[model samples]
Target: MDDTAIDYAAVFQALPGMVALLTPGLVFADANTEFLKAARRTRDQVVGRYLFDVFPDNPNDPGASGMRNLAASLTRVAATGERDAMALQRYDVENPDRPGEWEERYWSPVNAPVFGPEGKVRLLVHRVEEVTELIRARGGPTGGRTRVLEAELYTRARELQELNERLRRAHAREREVALALQEAMLPACRQVGHHRVAVRYRPAVGALNVCGDWYDLVDLVGGNRIGVSVGDVVGHGLAAAGVMGQLRSALSAASRVAMGPGEALNILGRYASVVDGAESATAVTTFIDFDDHTISYSSAGHPPPVLVHPDGRTEFLDQATDPPLDACPDPIPRPQAMTDFAEGATLVLYTDGLVERRGEDIDAGLARLADSLARHREEDPESLADAVLLELLPPGGATDDTALVIVRL
Candidate 1:
């Protein structure tokens, strides 16, 4: 048989594992049926697209290393003309039927460089074997292994278990550090002027819950005016916390020189647009005037502030609000809503995490908050804040960070 007569394309297509040929520039040259099945993509969808553009990292999870590791491996293979095998990686794939939805997948990959007749790297061969099910099974026990392979399987399982344990410990340590950093950045709840203030911050239950929920109280230049704010940034981890700190500091500074709540929020919205890595944030800022016995507040896509009257009647100050900071290209004027606060009345400000749940409607959460506030209307500000958190969040923990602020006249 002539070697030139062999159908290389047929042989490549018959391979069981996922395989793709990439050009020197990393464009998809050819992909086998297995590769198409694993990627959930057609030849037309991926053939001409850049590798990263076709399969980018998960936007919501900044810690995902699949794209980074794959890129590095390809670059190394191109430079050294050698095969590179990578460890297991969590590479999420987008659902073809549902836009913006991702499905979790784990893969072990190997990259080998294909050389041209000129002795230069021309094409790259990439192969992947999915092991997501095997990994999930290894966490528990498995049955029906032959005695000959039992020892080998047991050793491999033990190694995987140890790796998972180490990852868990590392995540725990990271959570601890992030919590401490968030705590150090947040402002302490204390009295401002004659108004009594109390604040509560509860981070989410798991290791990944450390986020950018923040509340702050700022004393304006005038003794009779105080500024209060609560905000939730878009993502989690140190990046979100850092953006929260920057926005908090900017809001505080703006409160000192700016006229009122609307002006402060306008400044914050403008600043958020220029800041790097800031996608968007929701915030509510209020200007409390003791001399006037009134509260003026503005919201940037945040939940409405709740007010409890001296008679225990509760009202949500829902008003026409602008979009969240950094959410849009053009800036819109933030409108301030004014309402009178009677003596002994209380006001509550909180992030969406205080009210939002996985399957529950947000309106229901807000209604529950109002009910909780009305029930604890007679308590002091400190006690009222504590009661609300205890009632809503309970003991175990919430799925997202919760920040609450209560002010009593």
Candidate 2:
């Protein structure tokens, strides 16, 4: 069967057992048919409502522990990102037919965590099997047969708990591998010439901890010059990361011996034409020559680097720009530009993630970056990097990977 064509909503409603979806805040998101039937609730009645609000503790049962026990179990799942298989509990539900009356019920419930990309509990899968009939047949809740059923249910719950633990471990391992791959591909920050360099990389908040965005710094042959570049591949995760590694390495190697940033990018563009998944990738490279007091730069459809003077003036280096990698029908020389910078001026190189936001023009994002850089012009490279990220990214973090490099010249 074509999975994409399958009707997931239909499948969910048709599932054999009672199942419900809850947000981390314990608000009902959805409920399957069996769940609605078991609770005598309509979809409209439960969805978007808080669990406790819909099924408050039985008012007549002065010692009702149902809500307390179930709340504790759900809280555990949310806090720990683990499953909590609750023992059979006596939770009474209001009789829909008789408004003020309550119907005694026993339920075997299990709450499991559903993790988002950041490995946080995004939702809870609440599954339950009502055993009111079984308990009643076994001579009420305190009967010997009821105790035996509880024991059997507990054993099954333990098995389910073990399975959940294994799934969690596997998820953790995948995250570790993604992080290790990212660390391995990206280099450590270091000082180049008299300037302090700071680098930052944040993967998108998702199951994968890596993306196509990358940054590099190469201390050129002469101690007075250093080459720094930032590039973004077209995708995320391992496939994009693999392409990023290849493109970054090519640029680094070319920058070492190429005559200028434009020449290095031309070489990289040619290489990109042959590398799979490199099409439409964008990059910007800058060579800071301390001795000459000049900054030479080039862009392959990437955003211009920002230059912040000591006196709080900001300039965007957009003079030299070109289409993204392999956008040209044939190999051609890329454009380069040179500008002078005074001592203590700071240069910022970053991927689009630092400025791009949903539903906003890129110019707005660039303006925000320029304003932030001007405000923090005097800060050191590390402080400026931190400030830029704090000001530009959303409160929850960016939706895409961001690779940033800051150099104080």
Candidate 3:
């Protein structure tokens, strides 16, 4: 009991490790400064407290009693004078100061009893280590291990970014190639009997990579008459865009000699039918011929053009004379039908991509397109046509390319 003996009191009070000398009862007898710091308590608060009273419950526990086990281990060690060890995996303990976060802790314990002159166990020396840092080090990579893992992660992230960039570039290149092919195949404005006319063509959204819709307007007869054609090739990307160009050119050449819609489409279809690459080629075309006050058109497996009378009446023209060109040799479109274009009549030609949507049936899409065109017929032909296109197709409705042209008489 003297202060000068081995200063067991001073030794226990100053040890760096979490040191606590307990009685055989597993009750706190005396603890070191380090133990108090780890416990976040002072001797006045911890002395005489049972070990199980302060031991926290396990979070990943099976509802087994860990607190009681620790007390039993303490009693067993004190009785046997043997050393023991146990691991605390992520024992949930909150920093009283920073309650927002919890800490991970691990413990290594050993309790040994000292003997007195009477030869019975006199004092139980309980030593503990706050192996928090050691456990964290074990959980994470170290030195070269950390570097190797970091290198692998960095490499994986870089590969992902590189793949993303490559995909974007590929998409852009596809669009450029499709557009360039369409532009190259398009014929310059020509006279269809005597009018200086031009054409309009638009590709669908991602279909820029493979535009399927196309149009051609010609001023035949040296600017005396006008001829127009619209078509959809059964594909996307380069193949569709290429077919559109071929048809537009074929129409330009055929219309010079034959100004009738049925004849022009027939001529083009025969040429396509005899061509090789059947698996990769098929097209539907609608041709229209317009003079001073008359209009005639023929369809070949393509959507019919819409004609709006000056009196606000609308006509949907989908009755085709033949199946899509290229299905067989010498597909003949029926005789073209003639209609009078009074002062206010306007003809609208477009591909289905302009009027169709994913979840909608063909009838609904067609009806909506007709309704939209009627609402905007009072505007200039170009404005009316553009308005109708935007309304029916909206920004994303047509996944493929679209082409539209409006003629006012």
Candidate 4:
């Protein structure tokens, strides 16, 4: 596949119909070529101006309701985060050649919401179709009998549109609730002894921002040790999140009393066998002991953690890897690995989303991560975490959720 970057701004300018991008507050962000041509305006004249300020109601038409009606439709879209199509109306645009002159026109206008990552209406897509010629062909300004028939058709179309809008709103509400639940279950970042720690969780682009990736940091009973883990469940959405919460809680609880990372995962595997939707989940656990300067780790079909030394060397903690949770029919012991670290080493634990790409070799992804770690080995954990994400993720984001934890020793 070609790795060339796409110029979305150029694409938007080339789109066929009359379209404009507006902020939630109705300020014009951009307008396509057709839109500017139809309005007889330049991009410099409209962009960054308020919608009504740019296209105010004509002073000559005392009874003109075009501005009022269009404002109502746009307001509904911004407030409800839904699309709104306005009924046919008479709106006039200024005749650019003639100062203080308004040319009468009719239009079919629609406003749709654009959402940001947190699911709020970040912008509004305002699209308008000029129907002046169609109306004039029917019969002059009023359209005679044709106007009445068109009104009836519009009424029926609006009825169906409203029904579909209601269904979409319900689905959006459910998605928000599920996302909130997952966020509440995730642990907040905390320092591990004198070392700095940073954590980040990002859901996939098309998954409604709901995914089964999670990370945890727990202080062990002894004062000098801490447990950190990252996990990914098989699927996405509400069910996957529920399973993730259960498994995370079980493993966190087991990490306290269990002898090592392997024992803790063994307990979690047993618990996962009984939980619905918990099969085939992958996880990696690491116990960092500041006093002993040692790192004990275990993996359950998860990507290996990377350790970056001060001398610009990178190491993968891959020796303890085993099959995913609940993969074996009967209970069995999990593998465990340990390694010594220098005082200035950085340890990174992450889910597979950070490395895996569709139709690409997994080794390529691992090398990408190793390169990023080596380049930024001297950065603190917070900055290193940000650098890794910026280097590894695509422009739009990954296709799967990512959970990342970085500990600076």
Candidate 5:
């Protein structure tokens, strides 16, 4: 053989899955065509560059361990002058065409050190077998005992899938039941004395979980005074809805005999603490005196009501705030706040879900609500309520259940 004149680069490039020669300083000395193809790069882009700079870890993925694991394997191979084999790794790579997008990949890597005449490590030979397809086809790692384990895993996975489908159907049925219960308990929009009332109830977007948000309007004391209540029970699903039903019934019974908003909330709070799983509920109760043309209200850690005037003025009723119901075993008297009720004024009461958004301060949400109300202040009660919802929670915007009541007196 003409050993002195032989082209060793041709042999290195030809024999490979994906192979790269790294210098002692972890700089890429050379890489095969297969390595460049897998990296979505060219020879000019990869050669003579630091390995990490050429192929950095995916920044968006916090669990990306490819660079760290490969570096450790190379270091071990260089220090001990022995081969280092790594297990399957979830290595994400950035798309060359799409910036900030990562493609998921798996690799089985082996690092072996090359020695110089002095018996010191000179270059590290890194080889990677792209086993992403193989692992996915086998549904897991495959080896000597994997065939038997894979069969068992396949059987268990099918059984689990069937079990999950059954559970999903059961949850759907429960959600339907809860929705029916909620709809039956909710009062329809109607005229209460001289005022026109409108109500809206929307379930949270996505999923079959039913939440515990409700609104009510009841005539108080000889049908002259009216009581409006909006409450949200903590959590969701069947348990929360059941608690909401209990609270609604208790509040209705208490409002009949209670003197005002403060007394009504105080009674409802005491009743809520006794009900199972109802301790963390929050509410707002308001009483309207038609004869006196006045409005008195109280809150139990709930969002304050927004009062919109006929002439396009708006104000949030933030005073007389108290802790959520059942926050204390023996609750204190909820103080009441009163304001003049103009003939054409509209009062808006709602659950927090109507205004709250993820990653935003509640104050911002309130400001948005106020702006929406001021924009639609001239519309009728039903149209105004609908407009506010469309503005705050457009399609696919709500993450929690929402209940809203609008009263135009």
Candidate 6:
């Protein structure tokens, strides 16, 4: 019991470690001078204190471990003593010397049974060392520091996953809206008066979705004449497609009530100005008449129709069209522009998406469009529309929209 007591004191005190004696409840019982300095508190302040009680919560700190059931974990280790020698705990410790800032700490906890006078285990000895600098040098969060890092990473990962999911849903919604609008706006195969009409409608080249392009054939004046029309609403996607549907309905009704294409378009423009809340300012119209003979007719502003002559020659009837619809109220109707339709002749009604280009000259593009029709003049109206549109429309899809109506007399 008294073997070299003076030497033992000299060696243990100067051992260059944070040595401490702790009760079973983890309260400080005794400590070396090094231990007092590391805890950043003197013996009077720390001797009887519990570990967590000294380190109170800091509300704004992200490194703080929230609520943990450490009591159970600590109890298990203490009872078994299986992992006591090799036990380690990591935590975020507010710098004991400096308060708010935290550093990672690793505690290599060694538990030993202290014997009483009866040779039975009466107390536990917990030796501690402040390894915050060592852990920082190794680039790790230890003790409470590790828990803090884990919490921050978990929360960040959850937020990132949620953001990705939200983006996916937004894309899906846009696709659905575009699809529904296309179905509602595009023409379906149907007849105009006695002429059995077939409609083939596709979105603009490159766009892969519906734009303001539209086509329609109306039974004019109760089967006396068939009025065919095609127009492009300015813009892209759902907004333009919506306007196309409105114009399609109005154009059909207007043509049916009036006697000729010119008068019909004039009335259409008048009504459009009233019904069109915003688009009344920008609307284009072109008309087609088929009654045994074909006449290329236009009203308001629109791309002129390409006449595929009975003699297999195609020409763009480029006389200036009247002012665009809805710009003025009840505008005067000009004489219906006429082009004689041979029995074998086909008339191509198309929106400017067939010819317009961003970098290329507009007139040359139109001429090319006319030339393309002439090349494909021998093909059936349905086949002719396809071939010409594919060639003249070029690449990158329809930046605007396109509509095509072919009338073969």
TM-score of each: 0.61, 0.62, 0.57, 0.63, 0.60, 0.59
TM-score between candidate 5 and the true structure: 0.60
Candidate 3 has its poorest 10 consecutive residues by lDDT at: 277-286
> How accurate locally, in lDDT, is each candidate?
0.83, 0.89, 0.64, 0.88, 0.83, 0.62
lDDT value, candidate 1, whole model: 0.83
RMSD of every prediction: 17.6, 17.0, 23.3, 14.9, 20.9, 19.2
Candidate 1 wrongly placed segments (more than 4 Å): 1-151, 191-194, 207-209, 394-396
What lDDT, from 0 to 1, does candidate 3 have?
Answer: 0.64
User: How well does candidate 1 score on lDDT at residue 270?
Assistant: 92
Shift in Å, residue 281, candidate 6: 6.4
TM-score of 4: 0.63
TM-score of candidate 1 to 2 decimals: 0.61
Task: Give one digit per residue, the lDDT tens place, for model 4 in 1-409.
Answer: 3536877888899999999999988899999999999999999999999999999999999999998998898889999887877777789888888979999898888789999999999999998888776656456656744764675477559757876887888888988888688667888765345558988888888785667998888889886899999999988888888888899999989999989999999998889889988889989999998889899999999999999988989999999999998897786999899999999898899999999999999999999999999999888888888999999999898889998999987
Distance (Å) between predicted and true CA of 209, model 2? 3.3
lDDT of 3 by residue, 1-409 (tens): 6657676667657777887877787778778899888878777867898765555555455554555556766777667655544333234455656754546555555556777798777777777655455435454556545544544455466546645765787788776776678657765544343342324566555556446566676655543456777777766777666666666678678876775777776787777665433232333333333435766677766777777876667887655445676765545454567666676667777777776778878788778877877778778765776677667766555676677777665
Cα shift from native, residue 343, model 5 (Å): 1.5
Which segments of candidate 2 are over 4 A away from where they belong? 1-163, 191-194
Which portions of model 4 show Cα errors greater than 4 Å? 1-156, 191-194
By TM-score, the best candidate is: 4
Best model per lDDT: 2
Off by over 4 Å in 3: 1-147, 170-172, 187-202, 274-292, 318-320, 330-333, 395-397
In candidate 5, stretches whose alpha carbon ends up further than 4 angstroms from where it belongs are 1-161, 190-195, 207-209
Candidate 3 vs candidate 5, lDDT winner? 5
In terms of lDDT, the poorest run of 10 residues in model 6 is 80-89
Tens digits of per-residue lDDT for model 5 on 1-409? 8897888989888876899999878999999989999889899988899999888899988878899999998988889786766666668778888878988777767778899999999999998877555445444444524644444455466546645765787777787887788777777655365568888888777634457887888888764689998999877667778888888888877888988888889998888888988877999988888778888999999999998888878888878889988997988888989998788888999999988988989999999998998888878888998999998886875879898999887
